[model samples]
Target: MNQEFIDHIKALIKNKAQSQLKDELQKLHPADIAELLNDLSYTEAKDIYRLLDNEIAADVLVEMDEDIRKDFLELLPSATIAKRFIDHMDTDDAVDLMRDLDTEKQSEILSHIDDVEQAGNIVDLLKYDEHTAGGLMATEMVKVNENLSMPECLKEMRAQAEELDEIHYVYVVDDDDRLQGVFPLKKVITSPSVSKVKHVMKKDPISVKVDTPLDEVAQIIEKYDLVALPVVDSIGRLAGIITVDDVMDEIREQAEKDYQLASGLSQDVETDDNLFKQTKARLPWLLIGMIGGMGNSILIEGFESTLTTEMSYYIPLIGGTGGNVGTQSSALVVQGLANSSLDSKETVKQVSKEAVVALVNATIISMLVYIFNFFRFGPTAIITYSVSLSLFSVVMFASIFGTLVPMTLERLKIDPAIATGPFISITNDIVGMMFYMMLTRLLS
Candidate 1:
């Protein structure tokens, strides 16, 4: 809604027109209500949120921004949280909300849940690392036995389907509850009632282990174009299922985090986050960049006589080019790693490719600078050759350095995106200045 509509709602809130406010909010989708709540004060949000029905309130709670939801939940009692929100949420979402609460609060909320089985499932899921398939999956999917006849399987599926939002596949399992196959809904009509579930279902269906990494799970779903992927335990028993929507949400959160790290933030920081959190995420890198700048100044001071002020004139051209080239190279390598297109096994090949591209860029850039210097300072001046050679060396070194750092980080099990941040930019700047001074000293 626009600011004008929000203002109208705020006016209703101020006037304490409960019925009118309730009527207007009832008309909004859960996502829209969540958005509207985000734009209001805690008092206003709480007042408006109370008017929503339990199911819509649970959905709106899930849709609300994480920061807002955290604060909003704090004002509520544990019993209220369990009854009004947790009762209506899917197991996965409930676990997520539980994770945000303190240990004492979590126990209180869990105790208030009416569904003992669902509460147990949430507790079981919470044991896994949040970055695993086990944590991301929901226990709400439909599963039937392989021994059932077609008619029996269909009956079981219909009963379970009523409880779920949508049925992507009806999982078939053995008497041991081990996954045997996936039952296609089309087969329900096409296959005869006389056939056994195992005989008609798609056998040896693709699935991921519960302990599989979340990223690997996303890759499997993406590769096979699955709407839902079943999770299995160590013994191949069906555990839970991860839906496409959950995977998409995970992907978006991961992308945002990677972007923040690449931009030099240590952790995720929203604009609305408190001042200390914002500063905390941003300060360490700014301090590191400061140290790098000081190091550059000291290096230049040490070579004040050799640099001869004339060559110093192009320090910006040399440093800027190196930083820009390094940033470009690191960004591409990070991107390739994220999308799985570039494997660490091909490190030498990737670096060699970047080197060749660097050579072409270096030659063009250095030669262009050399020509400009020839006209700007006389052709016979040391400034001409030294500037061009320094640019050439800086470009080549920066390119190779940039490409290698991320690849090495990946091999060492560190995040490669860190290399694409101020880490690359500052390192290249300092090193580029050193190359410039050394080249100028040699030429003179």
Candidate 2:
């Protein structure tokens, strides 16, 4: 949010000419207002919102947090709002808003909506789950027939330009409305006037179905460095296009989900989400960890009798090594999987590479510890070797667990990021503690 722009909006709201404020706000882009809306309080945002036309407000509203948006909707009289603003919104944006609305509110809004076509589009979009490609795509796209000449295509585009928002790609379709191919606008413009779209356009355009997952869509866009990707139906008919901007949102949403899941919370946990709801989301993981800890305790208590001698003092050494190695491996594996780069071949390679690196560090560190033990406590070579071996094993185990757990989660269709910190830490702590104590009994 730009502070200067926010200040300008604030000053405008303070002035007497509330009527003129809408015209001034229209000058700013919807993205700018969306940014500013996030920065403002609900009340302050409502004031700024009322000044804008319904279309602008609806666009900005879709970008806002769920709680604040609900509050803003209530602030306005129900009759003053119409479905046209929402009608102007893309299918994805409309679905998001509809999903957040209360059952009664949703029914009321839909009933009041005059445009049957737009309302039906929203309903169609709402059928898909939120994370799917159908839920992310906008139905507003420019499509032209492959048979159209340059002059005919230009005239059609000029007429349709007002209806479409994201116009980076002009899709070439057949009589059946099936996507034949697509090319850059530059190609369309530079081609000879007599060249048919079919002759000029590249066939076999890379495309995705409407039901594809958001992360997969993001991956395709990123991999191809696309400005826009066409969304198609199961039969490969053109559905819509998801612009680069929406892909950016999907990336941010996925990143936030990864962060939340890594901390053992649901993807919906946001700053605006209620405390009790957030607490409930995390409590399950903490309880599971506690259960694991207690189970670990029972096992460790069995070794309480054997920790009576020289080895008791060295227990911490093994635990520390295991914890560090496990954490390092988990981080690498988690990142690899999250970015869709981790596979069995890569995992094997990564595990091998990481194992070598960890072993080298562990060997050097254990040698240093052994040297210190010799000078500080006059330990025998056997005792030093035992400790070194225990530490090395712990390090190796930690690295293996860290690399494998995330990969396993990915195989199960769970996010690999969730395996990074808390899950890694808990497993490492339990394994490290148990292994160190178990090894100590043998070494002693």
Weakest 10 consecutive residues, lDDT, candidate 1?
Answer: 307-316
Worst 10 residues of 2 by lDDT: 76-85
lDDT of 2 by residue, 12-128 (tens): 777745766677677878877777787777766777766776677777777776776677776554444454357567777777777876767777777777888877887777777
Clashing pairs in 2: none
Model 1 agreement with the true structure over 90-109: per-residue lDDT tens digits: 99999988888788989999
Clashing pairs counted in every model: 0, 0
Look at candidate 2 and tell me the lDDT of residue 339. Answer: 66
Candidate 1 ranges beyond 4 A from true positions? none
Highest TM-score among the candidates is held by which one? 1
Model 1 residue pairs with clashes: none
Question: How much lDDT does each candidate structure score?
Answer: 0.91, 0.75
Segments of candidate 2 deviating more than 4 angstroms: 1-32, 35-43, 74-81, 102-104, 295-297, 308-317, 344-354, 381-386
